[model samples]
Target: MNRNASRILAALFGVLAVTLPFFAGDYPLQVARNIMMYMALAITWDMLLRSGQISFGIAGLFGIGAYSAILSVIRAGMPAWFSILFAAIFSGVVAFVIGFLILRLRAMYFSIVTLALGEIFRIIIHNLHDFTGGPEGVVIQKGVIFGGNANSLYWLVLAGLAVALAASFWFEKSKIHFALTAIRNNEISAQSSGIDIFRWLLLAFVVTSAIQGLLGGIFVQSYGFATPDAVFSADFTLLPLAMALLGGVYSTTGPIFGAILLGLASEWLKLKIPYGHLVVYGIIIVIVILFMPQGLRQLVRRTSHSADGRSA
Candidate 1:
């Protein structure tokens, strides 16, 4: 797309975001916030995947952020805003440490290690009864940066989405893109060409982990409570993975589109099926992967091309 088209689309989205609260009630606004949050997470996850790394530790980083924010509030008596910053930093540090160990593995081995790491983090938190409230989790007792309210939480989530989106866009335009593409295409060749594959991969991992942590902080604060199972649930990992895969794994826009579509569907399905909604989600994921592996973005591109050809 051209810069003009991009600017126009962004302006339209901005207008819609600003006007959303005005048109929708509190419940709908809350749903919009959830959708945007997951969209941001999905995009960040895809960003790391761009470098040919498959990370399954999103829940681990997210849980770390949640616990960090909660503990900062309860133990340190810090302000909510400051705690969020601390949570992001803490998650990034953990990611930096963990990246070194797992970045050496490739494909399924790396994925399994990350998944195990997530479980390890969850079990550790679960065992820390005094600090984390064990499996019971912690009660936040306050709202987000403000105090307590839906609109405040909505704006907080919007800010997070904005930051994540901007970072992803910057990565696409910077040398990170070349580094990631090189790493993805051929690590040996990339290294021969002087690309620090390990360094770039580690950087991507840490950055994505920090964003996941930030989102977790927002999520826990928004709900005014946190639980080990809730924060470290497979839902967080599976939903974002499905969203990215469904929309288009490698492109930024793909996850946004997929998240919006699947987020809404998942919400509605919960009300309709209550118990089996997740089954529907799994089915959707399977269908998308089987039929449109390149994602809805590719489907749309193909349709546009066919239409243009017919017109010509």
Candidate 2:
């Protein structure tokens, strides 16, 4: 799409998003907030995937941020705004240290290690009874920013989505795009072309981790409590992965589209089969991977092309 068209579409979407809660009821607004949060997570995950790195530690870093934010608020009595910043920094530092070791690995090996790291984080939190309240987790007495009402929480999540969208757009448009594309295509070639593959990969990892952490902080604050299982659950990592893959991994629009579709489906599925909704998600993932590997975005593009060709 042309730049003008893209800008216009984005503006329209922004206005619609802002007006969503005004038209929708409380339940719908809550669902919209969840969709935006997952969209942010999916986009951030795709941002790192652009660098040829597939991480399973999204929930780990996310949990780190939640714990950091919660602890900061509970222990130090810091303002909620400061907690968000602290959580992001904490996740970034952890990513920097972990990326050094894990970035050395490639593909499936890297994914496995990251997954293991996530479990390790959960176990650590589970055992830290004094600080984290063990597996029970911590609760926030004060509400989220802006007094923690549903509308306030919805706007907070929207702001996070906006930030993630801007960062993703900048990354796609800047030199980092070339660096990550090069790395994704061929690390040797990228290095030969002076891309500093490790540095770029590390940068992507840290940035994505920080964003994940920020989202986790928002999740905990919005709900007013956190537990190791809830914060570090595989659901966070897997759902976003499925959303990105089902929507299309390399493009920004893919995750947003996928999140909107799957997020609503997920809610309805839970209502119908609360215990088996995950099974439905798994089935959808299987079908998409097996038949529509290019994702729903590609399917739409192909359909549009066919229709245009027929008209012509």
Q: How close is candidate 1 to the true structure, as a TM-score?
A: 0.94
Residues 1-312 of candidate 2 have per-residue lDDT tens digits of 333644586678678899987888889898899889989999999999998888888899989999998999998998887888888899999999998998999999999999999999999999989988998888887756677678888988898898789889988999999999999999988889988888988999999999999988888878778999899988889899899989888878888878888998999998999969899889988999998886887776667667667431
**Cα lDDT of model 1 by residue, 257-290, tens digit:** 7888899998999899996888987998899889
User: Number of the top candidate by TM-score?
Assistant: 1
Cα lDDT computed for each candidate against the true fold: 0.85, 0.87
Against the true structure, what is each candidate's TM-score? 0.94, 0.94
Give the Å error, residue 253, model 2: 0.4
- Badly placed stretches (over 4 Å) of model 1 are 1-11, 142-145, 310-312
Give residue 179's lDDT in candidate 2 (0 to 100): 94
